[model samples]
Target: MGYHFKFEKIMSVKEREKNEALSAYNDSVKRFEEVAEKLYELLKKKEDLESYQSMKLVSGLPVLEIRHHQQFIVNLQKSIEQYQKMVQNARNHMLFQQEKLMHKNIEVKKFVKMKEKGLHEFLEEVKHVEAKQMDDISIQHFVHRGS
Candidate 1:
């Protein structure tokens, strides 16, 4: 009576999987961006600190103040190193998610193609059946007119 794809359920499942994969990819990208931003900020702060330290040196700041600046710069470098690692890990995770999403998209596309092909075949069959019915009706009318 109606066109029904045998793999409709499978297609729906694949589509759902694709959506989940897409969401995961988006989340991973967000995480990567956040970590990268933090790393960038840390680097910028370190540069600014170094510039300030140089200015202080030119201004003849005290030895103790120079040591304090050096200590703070060291701590900033450690933090920057940690953030760099975090950013790398996040980027790797994002790439992994992207690959998974690509696979899911391909799967969904395959199922969609199958559904389209099935629908096309079903429509063709319907057209053939309708043409046969029309031919039968025409034959019946012709015979009645002959009688």
Candidate 2:
């Protein structure tokens, strides 16, 4: 049987942790992108409304209606501010997730390195034993021939 890696169980656990961390990071990124897209749309709408608000009023438009538009624009601005905050929060969350993923990655890599080192040492030991056995067999053959 092949040499069993001593740290195999630990390595597997670390790998699973890394996978979970990656999934969480991806989710965080997706959520951040969604919030950012919404913020962009809100900003675009605010810009369009502000431009429309700047237009000269003709006799066709009622004064009450114009004031309502102005009030609506103010409310929209407040909504935009709130969305901006949400976007920022999402970005922060994404950063936190990224950090967690990085930590997991590091842990997995450490275990992988340990396993590799262990395997290399095992192979070297096996090689040495094989060479020693070969030497002993050749010496025995020579002794039998001499007899």
Candidate 3:
């Protein structure tokens, strides 16, 4: 009975740890996804800027087109830098999440081992009790035979 109680306590602690780890991982994943989406948006904006720069004006205007193209290039460079930073941040978060998952896995393995050991001990105790009961019955039968 005491063993059972201890096993339950261990299981409860393991469960709470697992839940906390899962929540933390989920939050990390969400943040990574948001960063990825922002990066994608930035890339799309850069593509649009490139497409705009390729457009030809009706007045055969080289000067205005060149100035506009230079400004677009500068904006594109800034967007690219921002996108790169976001991607790096996301990668860092993913690595952190992976590390957390590995730790959680180790904890789960330990709890499983404890649960298995506890069950084995309980079964052995039950078996011992059953054998003792059978022995008691056999002794009673022998005494009745003599009577």
Candidate 4:
């Protein structure tokens, strides 16, 4: 007899759900990396600007120009802060989605293992039946030969 799992459909649905959850988690990770890279680039720009401002100090630039540079630095800092938040939120979302994916994976694995175990038992039963039939046929052949 063919081995059949009663909950095979449910297992398949759970497998699909796991795949979707994994994709969502991967997207979240990508978004977090993008925001983090933007933040890192912004910080590097601020450092370079500071270096330029130090060079201007030796030449004694105008006060207005100094103020403008400082304002730009402040704006950059704010942008970095916002991007940091976005990265953090994305990280949190990735973690949540990962948890969901893990659960779905476990659910599907449980059913798959159960089905495998059932199939193993079914194959063993078939082997036993086949062996008994072989023995019965061999005994009948021997008895006819003796007669």
Candidate 5:
């Protein structure tokens, strides 16, 4: 004997949508991490360049070299700032999505529990009916045989 509930299919649909949103949020987080990593590398490179500039023994280094170092440092600062903001924003969005997912999961769980409870009740009812019918049949057979 099988017991089925009408809301099972609706729960599946809600689960699928929540999963898809989570996947997309994860992808965004990964992209933000990559950008942050690249920014860190650029900052490191800029620091190395600054260190080299300070360690120069020759006082007559070309003006172009000095200008290049300055420009590189500025660009690295801007990149770091931009990526930091991006990472923060992505993290915030991910948090919001996670909260939404949690709520959705809670809803689905409630529906699932309800469906299970309903199915259990239905099974119990079926069993009771079957048992009653068997008792009736046995009583009738006994009476007929006795007569």
Candidate 6:
């Protein structure tokens, strides 16, 4: 007879769960990266605007134009703050997903180890039975020859 693991179904279930967790983790990472990139772009734009505003000031730009620049800069700062919060939230979610994936991986490994141990025991039992049958045959052969 072939070796059969009693927890084969459970092992299969665990493997499926691991795959789902991995997919979720990947999605979280992607979202986090997108949010971070947006934050970087926002910071770069703010820097460029501040630099241009400084250059314009030295070139004797009108007071009205200066006010407009200041207003736009304030709006940009508010947006940057909101984006920063979004980035932080995304990072937290990614970390949570990573932790979940790790747990699923550990569970799958445990089931795999149990299956390996069970198979090893089954093989050992098969070997022991074969050896006993061989000894019985040898004794029978010797007795028949003597008779």
lDDT of candidates 1 onward, in order? 0.93, 0.88, 0.79, 0.90, 0.82, 0.95
TM-score of candidate 4 on Cα atoms, chains taken together: 0.91
Error of 1 at 68 (Å): 0.8
Please list the residue runs of candidate 6 whose C-alpha ends up more than 4 Å from where it truly belongs after superposition: none
Regions of model 5 farther than 4 Å from truth: 57-64
Prediction-by-prediction clash tally: 0, 0, 0, 0, 0, 0
Write model 3 residue lDDT over 10-99, tens digit each, in one string.
767877887887787888888888888887887888787666656654435588777977787788789879878977888798778778
Clashing pairs in 3: none
Candidate 6: residue 141 Cα off by (Å): 2.7
How do all models score by TM-score?
Answer: 0.97, 0.91, 0.82, 0.91, 0.79, 0.93
Ranking of all predicted structures according to lDDT, beginning with the best and ending with the worst: 6, 1, 4, 2, 5, 3
Q: Residue 100 of candidate 6: its Cα lDDT?
A: 98
By TM-score, rank the candidates, best first: 1, 6, 4, 2, 3, 5
lDDT of 5: 0.82
Instruction: Give model 5 RMSD, 1 decimal.
Output: 2.7
Q: Please give, for residues 1-147, the per-residue lDDT of candidate 2 as tens digits.
A: 487888789889889988998999999999999998988888898888767766646335678978998888898889889988998999999999999999999998888788888889999999999999999999999999999
Q: What lDDT is reached at residue 115 by model 6?
A: 88
lDDT comparing candidate 1 with the true structure:
0.93
On a 0 to 1 TM-score scale, where does candidate 6 land against the true structure?
0.93
Q: Which candidate, 4 or 6, has the higher lDDT?
A: 6
Stretches of candidate 2 off by over 4 Å are 56-62
Which should have the higher lDDT, number 1 or number 6? Answer: 6
